[model samples]
Target: MIFAYNKAHVGDVLMILVKNDNGADVTSTRCGNVTKIALKETNEVVAWNIFQASEMLGEISGVGQVVLSDEQIALLNEELAKEGFREVITQEKNSKFVIGFVKELTPHPDSDHLNIAQVEVDNGEMLQIVAGAPNIEQGQLVVVAKVGAMMPNGLVIWDGELRGVKSSGMMCSPRELQLENAPDVRGILVLEEGSATIGEAFSPEKHWHG
Candidate 1:
């Protein structure tokens, strides 16, 4: 497995999908059967596109189960190899998140339930992020968004999605990703594990353990 950045354009999420093509009737279908996933990079495969694979092939045969296809795997490898990225064999990236620390968290002057925080991400890059969580506090090791982050729920973190407002990225909590044990509330989360130093990484790997 790989930690592909989840992207949505039109209507799809991208991942460094690992599947075996057990040779089914990948052919014989017209369109929308197989989907096209572009392996892209901005230094790495930072963004990708998804579409019906059948459409990309435009009348072909011998396409089989993407999860069990040697040919498909080879094709994917070939693409990445061309770009110098090795094949990923573990699911670590899938369940982990690298985050920055929040040096300061201040209440938003505009709203009561809202708060503005000064977060230090990437060791040096600091940002003023507006948050709305009760438990959030100063000097807390919180999750930092390094620009391009996609919530598991398919909400793109680009400029805020609030009322006529723009947000840079998100300071994620467990529930946003729908962790099984995530507290049911709208609030920021404090990491109990991992270092939240700027540019560092953390993940909800523990969330699925129980």
Candidate 2:
């Protein structure tokens, strides 16, 4: 999740995007302090905007470095109160990223160095993706930039076609994924299995998979 606010530009609400891509046509439901955003057809809770973030008790996991503004937290609380959800915001934050396991790898049909990979994000879901990095290996713990993720390069993850094949998110390389000081090389990043938990914020456990 990302938070942005402009104090000097205008007195507007801070924006937190649960889903990276929100279409223009959105349906909103206000339940006390929580506001639910959904598509008309699916009614899936694609995004949530709470009036107060602190008033929450126990849903969040992990320890994120984020410090939500009082206004933003209050907004989330207000929305939550409206929703009638139990007042439960957890002190822990969920993982937004997880180490993906590459189950299969294939050469990209249209690209010289790119390869198509079927990566499992520990969520039990497999995604077909294209990557240019070379050292990607099957059964390895690779970093997964799942769908709806926003790259440090400002690239938005979404469904798209690559060389006649439909690609879902991306398998990250330290450089292409835009991590700090990622090696500027031609290999994909392989996460040490012990480095990351199975799920939480960036992890599939915390993120919506279905």
Q: Write the per-residue lDDT of candidate 2 for residues 7-88, one digit (tens) a residue.
A: 3342233344555334646788776555676677766555665444434532332222244545545556555665675442
User: Quick one: how many clashes does candidate 1 have?
Assistant: 17
CA lDDT, every model vs. true structure: 0.49, 0.59
User: Can you give the lDDT of residue 150 in candidate 2?
Assistant: 55
TM-score of each: 0.52, 0.55
Please provide, for model 1 over 16-70, each residue's C-alpha lDDT reduced to its tens digit, 9 standing for 90 to 100: 3333222222211112222333222212222222344323223223211112244
RMSD in Å for model 2: 7.8
Q: How many clashes (backbone atoms < 3 Å, residues ≥3 apart in a chain or on different chains) does model 2 have?
A: 47
lDDT score of residue 45 within candidate 2 = 52
Clash count for each candidate, listed in order shown: 17, 47
